[model samples]
Target: MVAPPPIIVLAFFCGTSIARSASPGPARPAKPAPIAADARHKQLTFRNRPRVVRSGRMRRMNMSTSQPGTEIGYTWPIRVYYEDTDAGGIVFYANYLKFFERARTEWLRACGVDQHRLAEENDAIFIVRSTAVDYRAPARLDDIVKIISRIERLGRASVDFVQEAWREGTLLATGSVRIGCVDRATLRPAAIPPSVLAALRHGPGTSESAD
Candidate 1:
């Protein structure tokens, strides 16, 4: 056979090298985008971690304690209705007391103590003995305020609570209220029932030594 031309030999060698170098092996999927990579990492991390589902009461407790100027307590949300506002378009000052009252009631309910039931079954009733309130800021109409109620002192026949009203992280009002236990029929001072006392001491966001 005639010797191949030098140019043809060079071309053949180059083609063979390229074919060998470009041969397909195992295929790799494309790399993920940066965001996708981060998301995937988060997903894996979440899967590997223990999942904790907190109850509503626990969530409120955590939220109340995590913020500045907030005490560990039971929190309740209240919406400002038009009727709750004054002609100046701000929440009426007295309405904050109402808000505090509602929160305290809810707190007691959360403690598994029903006031009506307590009165009917145990002949026990709770009455507000005293209240001292300080208004810090004004809450406008339609504002949703969170009321935090914490036990300050547990007396033999009375319980004092420190209540605060917060709007969007701003403390609007703070009040100290004392609730006294009494006999529903006699209206005389009475000791808080053992069951109710136990419930209050073990209520959500409260420590055993709270009393």
Candidate 2:
């Protein structure tokens, strides 16, 4: 073949370089690594553990106590796990707060209240304003504890609760929690919706307790 002029070859090379430069390459995002099988199994196990369980075995029993006018309003059962214990092996004092919180949440659910719906539909949410807990004894791992809760006082925007932790008729702890209603967006105090207030007053202690 006859050789082209050096200027012609140079022009062709320059045009190819310009074309390559102007047409950008496609971008490929890096893919996330897949989770390991063991990790996947652990995650599934955690998800399978339910937040609450109400069974037919949980029957309402009118409890008589030493305290004046003390009556059980709601009861929730909890099993102490190793994670709930402290270095000394007994249930951690602070973990009682978690127990009390769970009991109150379940109590409200029994009262026909859904906290998520309250926040989304009514713009209202419940917040713990104050809490006082007294420890009488220690709870150990694998022990099934019952949290007995009752309304000590009810107000337009807040509620006072009396909660106790018991195991086989032994009192482990007692807590007084005050919950206040607030506007979810503004975080300012707000009145409890009338329907919710009515439910709180009438829903619990009116029917057989879920076993």
Candidate 3:
């Protein structure tokens, strides 16, 4: 073969080297955009959201002999509505107090103690004196939770109760509440009426711990 001209060969070599140098190296991946702090917090909240079970799959918690020395009284089943939950669809911690209140009210009604009548006839109304609650698991929206209320201590002017919120076999929250009788007009502490106290003592499914 005939040799190429030196100048042409030199020019071709230079052009090839220039082209190789100008060409891009392996493409680098694009950098992802930074996530907003609030958005990252929301993502983590969603990722760590409590496990929710469908209503159809829910099973009642057994009130077996596991709880010894404690008598289980009335149970009020409450359906969790949208208003009761927070943004994450979990029941708000404060709402459990409302659940306990409802269960206690129902227990009173079952025991033939009507608050309205008691207040009108006896000039006395029950008021919550104090509450102590501990949260365990969480109840989700659309869940049917059972509030179990039992009388822990019964006194002349006040009563103490132990309440629990349960979903299936899972315990969601527990509370201890003390309710005191107060005069309707003065709001001062008053004694629970003899008839009302008697009803509470002998009411169906009612069992008070000895003082």
Candidate 4:
């Protein structure tokens, strides 16, 4: 072969070296964008959301039975709606009471105590005599709120319940409510019927003796 020009050969070698250096060698994958703090918080909340099961009567969600100091009791799941929220888009403080009420009502229903039937057949009804609630955090719209209701005490004509509102694993509020049995017509305190008393005694996480 005819000898190539030294300059041409040098230029060709230089060009090949430059092309090799410039050509990407197995392009490094792009690093994912750093998740924002709020986004990360939301993702974590969604991931830790309780598992819910839908049945014929109502929806039930399984919560951490392992939470120390928390009594394993009947749980009711509530979905926060726009009406349950305030202008701030968070659940109104008073709405937690409603959530607790629903949970307690469901617990009673599970125990076979239907308030309406009790009122009609037994001439008895349950009325909230007093309630104390401590707000720890706020729940927002579209959040699933789990209300855990446990009987703390049982009286001849009254029952005290310790109810808690939780989102994921965070406790939003805690409440103690005293419910009194009353005559439907007079709204005066009445002795809890034998059937109702039996139901309360055998209720989930309840003891025969008042706590």
> What is the per-residue lDDT of model 4 for residues 6-83, given as tens digits with 9 covering 90 to 100?
999999999999999998788788999999999999999999999975558521222223273454678889999999
The predicted structure with the larger lDDT, 3 or 4, is 4
- Roughly what TM-score does model 3 have, to 2 decimal places? 0.65
Cα RMSD for candidates in order? 16.0, 17.6, 14.5, 18.2
48: Cα error in model 1, Å: 69
Per candidate, the number of residue pairs that clash is 0, 4, 0, 0
Candidate 2 per-residue lDDT over residues 1-211, each given as its tens digit: 9999999999999999999999979988999899999999999999999797555853223333324234456878999999999999999999999999999989899998999999989999999987878898999999999888877677799887778888877888888778999999999999999999889878563323221
Candidate 1: residue 131 Cα off by (Å): 0.3
Error of 4 at 177 (Å): 0.3
Using all chains and alpha carbons, the TM-scores for the candidates as numbered come to 0.66, 0.64, 0.65, 0.65
- Kindly provide the TM-score of model 2 when superposed on the true structure, using C-alpha atoms: 0.64
Tens-digit lDDT string for candidate 1 (105-152)? 888989999888999899999998877788889999788998888886
Query: TM-score of predicted model 4?
Result: 0.65
| Angstrom error at residue 99, model 2 | 0.3
What are the per-residue Cα lDDT tens digits for candidate 3 across 75-156? 8899999999999889999999999998888889999888999988999999998787889899988999988887667789
- If candidate 1 were superposed on the true structure by all CA atoms, what would the RMSD be? 16.0
